[model samples]
Target: MIGVGKMKQYTNVLDKPLTKGKQEVSLSAFAFLFSELVQYNQTQVDNIGELERRLEDAGYAVGARVLELLCHRDKGNRRETRLLGILSFVHSTVWKVLFGKVADSLEKGTEHEDEYMISEKELLVNRFISIPKDMGTFNCGAFVAGIVRGVLDGAGFPAVVTAHFVPVEGQQRPRTTILIKFAEEVLHREARLG
Candidate 1:
């Protein structure tokens, strides 16, 4: 007979099947809402960077909470340690938990071993982001970067995460790439483990 905790775990897994289909949402609704949010922040923030930072910080809070929930649900019995292992966890587990799909690509920096990159062509939040000439400095993708930072830090791989738009051939929408640079201590630990 299963204990109460074991029963609850089984019920949770069964009740919420991992293969839940993606739900369609109105892009216009999201865009209008996001535009208003940006406008509202504009008055309170001193500059564009500060507004981006606020969005990033909001994402960081979401990421921290999401990470805790994900770990509890999927990896409750185990913890991640290695760099590549954690990277995979982020690309797959964290991505699915947050965006409902795994990232398009995850690459390690060739020149710098401590850096990793997650690239996605169509970022969800940036789907309808069209910065006018006056607001050329704004890129809402900083929120995504913040979420990545939260996931990495929660998994014990403290790092710096930044989001940027990199154009690729044959792609209309800009490719949003998240560059993650692990601190020196993380690299040293990885070396010791290897």
Candidate 2:
């Protein structure tokens, strides 16, 4: 017997095979949904920083789920155990699965041992919605930063993650950079593991 509200069995989503970043929702549809997410969060906060935080928190939930799914389905229950390995997994596998492409670049910070940066020429959130001048420093990419944080934290590598726009030499729209600063315990663990 089938329930009225529930979906009829059709291979069950969990039983279906995962796609190789090829399956996608329409870009316009995704943009519209993301825009709605930002707007809903906007109504909940008093300032730009708070808004970003809320967006990040929302993203963290997604990131956590992504980590779990990838761990079980894609990697065959194997999780990366090294710092660089995890970062590379995020930059390549995770990004590909989420956005249909790998991140543009991943780099270690020049001035700090605890920092790394993942940069994209045009981040998905930043691609469609343009920020007005009044909303200074309000980056929708904060959600993606949250996603990164969630993925890292779920993988036992907690860190502070943030998104910023950096100017290019000749480009009009600045690139978005997700900066990750590892927690003290993560660094200590890395050293001990080494």
Candidate 3:
């Protein structure tokens, strides 16, 4: 087992490099590893849906851990108490931390004040994924949605995150919009706080 000091050292090494505004990374390196991970998981899954679910679950775990680390890096700032505030924080901070860029758009739900949407022009994983005829239903966007869900839930938001493909004009890649539906209790609490 790794000792606490060793773990801290490793964390320090990882944190030191990324503390800067943004860092360039090799997409091919990440993509190759991700492909291998998917292939390995595919062996354990019985069907395509199961594989995708497993990938999403894995992303969720990553999100939970990432949320903690990010908050800790920010000196343990208290989680956002309002829906819009948290959504903005997620789009700006969380998106940058995870994807090196802020989301393309963030919109409020017209039907409900608690609901919000984060849309990305080109999700990293989907950039190179070409769905074959046999795997027409496969979409890696679920993994990203799971990440958002995990991050929000870990930060006490308890929201439902769903990924959808929204084709935009003049965009080569499919735009992914992640809809985050906050719990009513959260909104009520925020209202009370206000």
How well does each candidate superpose onto the true structure, as a TM-score?
A: 0.80, 0.91, 0.80
User: What is the per-residue lDDT of model 2 for residues 121-173, given as tens digits with 9 covering 90 to 100?
Assistant: 99987777789999887788999999999999999999999999898989988
**Root mean square deviation (Cα) for candidate 1:** 6.7
Q: In candidate 1, which residue pairs get closer than 3 Å at backbone N, Cα or C atoms, i.e. clash?
A: none
**How far off is model 3, as Cα RMSD?**
5.3
| Model 1: CA > 4 A from native | 1-33
Q: Model 2: clashing residue pairs? A: none
Residue 186 error for model 2, in Å?
0.5
Error of 1 at 176 (Å): 0.4
Which regions of candidate 3 fall more than 4 Å away from where they truly are?
1-23, 75-77, 111-114
Model 2: lDDT equals 0.90
Q: After superposition, how far is residue 104 of candidate 3 from its true place, in Å?
A: 0.7
Candidate number that wins on TM-score, 1 or 3:
1
TM-score for predicted model 1 compared with the true structure:
0.80
Candidate 3 lDDT, tens digit per residue, 84-122? 777777898888877888999999878987778888888
Better of 1 and 2 by TM-score: 2
Candidate 2 lDDT trough over 10 residues, lowest sum = 1-10
Using lDDT as the yardstick, the better of models 1 and 3 is 1
lDDT of 1 by residue, 7-126 (tens): 224445547644423434456776788678777878889888898888888778878877777777788646578898888888898887666789999998889988999998888888
Q: How far off is residue 59 in model 2, in Å?
A: 0.4
